[model samples]
Target: MSSGMAGANTEQPAGTRRNRTSEAGPAARRASRATDTNTEERVAVWDAVAAYVQEHLLVQKGVWIPTFGSFDTISKDIRTADGTVTLRWPVFQLARNLRAMHHLGSDKDSLPAHREVETLKYSEVAAAASVTWQRGKTCIQSTVSLLSNCLKNGENVAFVLKDIGVLLFEGMSFGIKYYYDFLEKLSGKEKFRKVVFKAPWLLDTLVSRVAPVASLTHSGHLVVFPM
Candidate 1:
């Protein structure tokens, strides 16, 4: 039996012997367990991140929440006696309110609103507003293209939500409205059209309509009137 044991030990390859010894050690077992656990944890985290991005950030309207900031989305529903119609949010609401208040308040109500508008233009206001400038710029460009396509194609109306912007138009008679919303609901739900504009007068009107201040560019933009 002793002779047989000696022969068996001698016949074993050095690499195989080393592997057996290492596998029997406590450190090796611990390392193997840790590698598996790490792999599983990474997979779980990645899956969660993907789910979060798709469900919340991939819609027609997307919202980016700045660090320590909150975002919200709103939709307006119009129900008439005949049927239900949904309008793009923030647009009609802001536009309608501005028109109404402009008629109702006249000069008396305008002064107070102007003061707030002045504050909004201050450097501090733009800096504090939770808007990503680069992102907003991209939104503007995408909206422009989408609207142009709709116009060129002779479509009466079209709405597109890109990562950077939401484009809404109502044919040749009206200008397209663009803005970012912090809120997003389920599919088929129409969001209220609350868009931030680059124009100062429009911004002031938006501020009066309860739209939060957002970062906007200082460069003057030219809008060519249709012939």
Candidate 2:
């Protein structure tokens, strides 16, 4: 008799399943709304930053976000085997921020310290115009604060722009490690002096800190980041 009863159908009624769905509907909707809100905030922040970079940095040397760091370009001439070529790298700096420095263990002191090469301070941060912050519900300051907190957790990545690449923070590494760098030339425009930007080459990071060539510093704006 027990075996026969076990073999009999014990399916839940359709209405019972519907009741469960109805019960979860509100909570599911709440979760969906929360995700959407977070996405909106992130998108808005990126849009503002993109506008600032396109408007100001393209014409000027770099853009400094007061509390955060500076996005300065260091232009240097390297005597390559081919010839002397001018390279521009829009260096994004956060090493100057006290809060961010506190999160990183010991090494990474400045945004992109010219260290690894031992003498290779990759490039220097040439002071540029600082962006005027507009008070808003979702702001850059708070967003960067969140990023610092994330870095403290030991695995996080923040990005400046799609073109520049990512700021990597991971376990097993002491300081900052940036990836996805490229070099492109913009010619024929003296007005609106275009800021040349590049990231560290994958091979460059894997192999050595500095490239195998002598770089001549034509203009040394030595003491940038005055404010």
Candidate 3:
């Protein structure tokens, strides 16, 4: 991605900080942000931004950046009956959350629970807690814009999301092919010791929610009573 925003490591004044266009105003903030930048700064910003998104994603249902859109997962229920189906896709919806954030005029609907994920315990700093959020988010928007530039420049482009996938833009089409398989990403894991004693996994019903009526027979019949 191209150079985004400003220096990611630029130390701010030692005092209270907040997420806003500016303490002074949008015009002043815009003026304060220098136009000149380089690839290194953008990459730093992106790395920080990607880390922030990954953190929020693990704890919350989804996360939204004002201009970048939404980062969330698409889950599919997996049950014994629904045998073959699997694989939960980590989805990146372009500009959907931006419109929503604008109409609502709040971060309530857009962002994940900020205070819930702690920097001390989880080593996660919420968007409001650190400058990283805004800086990273700006870089995210810049990253998207970089992909958009391809269509204008007429070139095939791929944006690498570390540990996630490569976002491809070719022939005026866009899609993400993930290198990591978030298979059954949200599905509950079985506590083998506690659950297996009750019933073997094959016979367990409703994702360990309900008792199985019978064991599966060799002939594929239900045997309520073993003998």
- lDDT (0-100) at residue 132 of candidate 1? 40
Cα-based lDDT for every prediction: 0.26, 0.33, 0.36
Cα TM-score per model: 0.20, 0.46, 0.44
> Which stretches of candidate 2 lie above 4 Å from their native place?
1-37, 98-100, 103-137, 171-227
TM-score of candidate 2 on Cα atoms, chains taken together? 0.46
Best by lDDT: 3
Candidate 3 C-alpha lDDT tens digits along 170-207:
44344444332221223324322223234333222111
Question: Model 1: residues >4 Å from true position, as ranges?
Answer: 1-136, 160-170, 174-227
| Over 4 Å off, model 3 | 1-35, 77-88, 96-141, 181-227
lDDT tens digits, residues 147-193, model 1?
A: 34334443322221222121222222332223323222332323322
Alpha-carbon RMSD to native, per candidate: 27.5, 19.2, 19.8
Q: In model 1, which range of ten residues has the least summed lDDT?
A: 218-227
Displacement of residue 94 (Cα, Å) in model 3 is 1.5
Q: Compare the candidates by TM-score and give the number of the best one.
A: 2
